[model samples]
Target chain A: MRPLDTAYMWDLVPVIASYVPLTLFMAIVAMAAALTLGSALAIVRVLRVPVLDRIVAVFISFFRGTPLLVQLFLFYFGLPQVVPAMTGIDGVTAAIIGLTLHFSAYMAESIRGAILGVDRSQWEAAQSIGMTQGQLLRRIILPQAARTAAPTLMNYFIDMIKSTSLAFTLGVTEMMGAAQKEAAGSFLYLEAFLVVALFYWVIVETLSVGQRRLESSLGKAVAR
Target chain B: MSCQIEITGLVKRFGDNTVLNGIDLCLEPGERVAIIGPSGTGKSTILRCLNWLDKPDQGTIRMGDVTVDAARATKAQILALRRRTGFVFQNYALFANKTARGNITEGLTTVRGWSAEKAQAKADDILTQIGLADRGDSFPAAMSGGQQQRVGIGRAMALDADLMLFDEPTSALDPEWVGEVLDLIRRIADGRQTMLIVTHEMQFAREIADRVVFMEGGRIVEQGPPAQIFGNPQDDRTRAFLRRVG
Candidate 1:
C-alpha cells in the first residue's frame, strides 16, 4: 500500500521458483491420471454400458459438484478420521487423488461431448469396413475426438496447474506454500505473492503457446 | 470366396415403422444390382442390413461363406459378413482425421491384417484408380464433394471386399460433381466387383445395373433385367414409380 518493493519481489523469485517442479509434478501426475480415467468414463457414457454407466454418472456428479478444496479436505482429513488406515496417505498423495477425481469429473463431460461431436458417419463407415469396435475407436473415432477435445482438455489442464496452489493447504510445500513461508518470514507478503503470481502467468502463457501448436498439428488433415 | 449373396425374409423395423419388409433376393458373384425407390421405402435399408449396420429385425443374410441370422447374429458373424463386404455412404463419410490415402489404408491394415507397406501400396493403387492420385494427401475437409466420394470409393476398393454396397452415394453431392463419382463407381464395377447400389440416379442405375429392382412400401415390387424394368415394366407400382421419377 505504501510503496511496492521491486527488489524484494525480484529476490523472492528464485526461492519460490524452486518449488515450481513440485507444483508441476502434482499437476502433471494428476492430469495424466485424470485424462485416462476421464476418457474411460466418457467412453462408458458414450457406449451407455449398463450399471457401470449409472455408477460412473453418480461418481462424476459427486466429484464435479463438490469444490476441489472440500474434496481434498474430505480425502486428507475426513477419510483418515473415518478410516484410521487411510491416515497412511500422505499430504502429497491426498492432494493428487483429490485433483484427479475433481478434474476428471469435469473433463469427462467435455470429452464425452467431443466424442459425440465426431460425425456419426465416421462410425458407420468404420463399421462398414469390418473394423472391430476397438479398432474403430483407436484408428478413427478417438483420433477425431482428440482433435475436437484437445483445446478443451488443455484448458482443463491449465486450470489444474493453477489449482495445484490449493495443495499447500494439504500440507505439501509446493509453489504456493513456498511463497507463504517466504512472506511470513520477511513480512513482505505483497512481494512474495506477486512473484509467485508472475511465475504462474509465465507458466500458463508458455502452455498457451504449446496448446496452439498442438491444435494446429492435430488440424493438419482437416486444414485447407 | 466369391460373393454369392443370398438374402431371405429380411425385415427391419424402426419402432412401429417397418423399414424393410420381408424381402428375398439372391446375387451370384459379380452381379450388379441397383435398387430404386422413394426415400422412405428402405432401398438403402437392404444394403445396411446385409452389412448388419442397421441390424435386421428378422432374416438371414448369407454373403460368401459367412451367414448372419438377424434374430441372433453374434459379434463374430456380423464382423465376418462385414469383412467380406464394402459399403459407401451417402454422406461420403470419409474419416476427417485421415488423408485420402490414410482412409484407404485404414481397413487394409486393421481389418485385412495387411502390413503397413502393403496397405500403403494398395491405397496408392486405389487413389490412382479413383483418378485422385495426386490428391492422396488431401483431407476430406478440403476436397470437393465429388473428390471426397471418390476417396470414399477408394477406401472401399482398397479393402478388396467380395461385395460392395453403395447407399445413394451421390445424393449428397452437388449436381456437377455427381458425374465424376458415378464414373468412378462404373470403373469399379468394371473390375467385376459384386455390387448392390441404392440410388436416386435413375439413368446411372439403368446404365450400371445388371438387374434393376423397384421397391415400394419397404418391399420389392418387382425386379428384372434393366431392359425389362426400364423398357417394359411389370408391376403397377413399378410403372408408377418409373413414370413419376423419369
Candidate 2:
C-alpha cells in the first residue's frame, strides 16, 4: 500500500468544502419541493376524492417500490427521450426533480398516517363547530399532523442528503461528483471517499439535533 | 332574539338499525335540558343529528330562523345552521396541537371573524371561568381529564353560542372529578345560555336540568320536568331504567 500524504489530504478539504453550497442547494430545493408535493398528495389521499385518490395511490406505490437510483435514471435519462423539452435541463435540475418525486411519495404516506392518527372525534367536533372541510384541515388538522410528520420528514431529508450523492451518476458535479473527480486524478480513493462520508455524517448529525429539538417541543404540547 | 331549538319527527337509521325514531321535543331559550338513555338508543345520535354530524332519516331541527330538515338539508344550509349551536363531546375533543387558549379562540377567530386580540380576551375570560386560567398555554394531553373538559367548555363558550350541547361530559371523568365538570356546566347553565345535555349522572340531571328527557329503544319513553321524570317517572321503562342506573 502507498504511504498516506497528510498535506495532500488536508488540501482537499477546502476543495471539497467549495461543493458544500451546491450539495446544500440541491437538498434544500428538493426538500421544499418534496414537502409541497407531498402535502398535496397527503390531502388528496385523506380526502379520498373519487378518481384522483386511485391515481395518487398508484403513483405512491410505483415511486416507493422502485429503487431511488433507478427512478433517478428514469427521470434524468428516460424522461428526456419522451419529452423534448426536458433535454435542455441540466443534470442538477433533473436530479432535484427526481429526488422530489421519489421522496414526496414516501412523505405523503407519512403525512397521511399522521393526519389519520388524530382522533376521529376531532372531525366530528370540527364539523359540529361549523368548520368547513377546508377550514377544519387548515386550522385544526394540519397543525397536529405536521407535528407527527415532522420527524419523518426530517429523516427523509437526511436520506435525501445521502441520496443526492447518487446524483453524481447523472453527471452533476456535486460533493460526491467532486470527490470522484479528485480521487480519479489523484488515485486516492480512500481519502476522497472518506471526506465525502464525513461530510454526510456531519450534515446528518446536525439535522438529527434539530429533529430532537422538534420532538421535545412536540412532547411539551402532548404528554405522550 | 329568541334562540329555542325545536326538533320534530327526528328519525335516523343506519341500515336496519334505527338510532333515533320520530323523536320530537321543544326546548325553550336558555332551557337546561338533559337527555338520559341506555346505550345504542341514539342518545348521542340525536345530539349529532341536531348539528347535522349524522344525517337523520327524517326530521326537522329549527334553530332561530334557520330550519334544517335533518333528512334533506343541503350541506351549505346545515353548516350555516350549526354555527348557532356549540357541541361538546364526552371525550373533551380539544385540538391536541393547540394550546388551551388556541383551542378556545380558533373558532371565534375563524368562524366569527373576531379579531385575534378580542378572541384571546374572550378565551382568557372563559378559561378563568372554567377554572383553567393558568393553564391557557397548556395543551390537552398536558392536562387531566377534568381540566381538559374545562378547556373544552371554554372552547365552546368562546363561541358565545346560543345553545351549548354537552354529550355526556361528566361520563368520561373519574368518579371524584365528575362533580367539578358538572358544577362548571351548572354555572354555565345559570348564566342563561341555552344548553342541551346528554348525561348518565342522574343526580346532576335531577339537580340542574330544567327538563329531563328519558329515551329507550330509540324513542323518548318519558319527557318532563326533572321532578316529574326523575322523581316520578310515568313509563315503566323509565322507572326500571332509573332504578337500574340509580
- Using all chains and alpha carbons, the TM-scores for the candidates as numbered come to 0.96, 0.93
Assess the local accuracy of residue B174 in candidate 2 as a C-alpha lDDT between 0 and 100: 88
DockQ of each: 0.74, 0.59
- Rate residue B169 of model 2 by lDDT: 93
What are the per-residue Cα lDDT tens digits for candidate 1 across A1-224?
Answer: 47999988888888988999999999999999999999999999999999999999999999988889999999998999889889799888999999999999999999899899998989999999989888898889897787788899999999999999999998899999999999999998888888999999999999999999988877764553
The digit string of per-residue lDDT tens for model 1 on B33-95 reads: 999987799998899888888989998999767888899999999998988888999998899
For candidate 1, give the docking quality class from DockQ: medium
Task: Tell me the lDDT of model 1 at B19.
Answer: 91
Reference-based lDDT, each prediction: 0.90, 0.88
Report RMSD (Å) for each prediction in the order shown: 1.9, 2.2
Among the numbered candidates, top lDDT falls to 1
- Superposed by TM-score, candidate 1 places the C-alpha of residue B164 at a distance from the truth, in angstroms, of 0.8
User: Which pairs of residues clash in candidate 1, taking residues 3 or more apart in a chain or in different chains?
Assistant: none
- What is candidate 2's CAPRI-style docking category based on DockQ? medium
Stretches of candidate 1 above 4 Å error? A216-221, B1-3
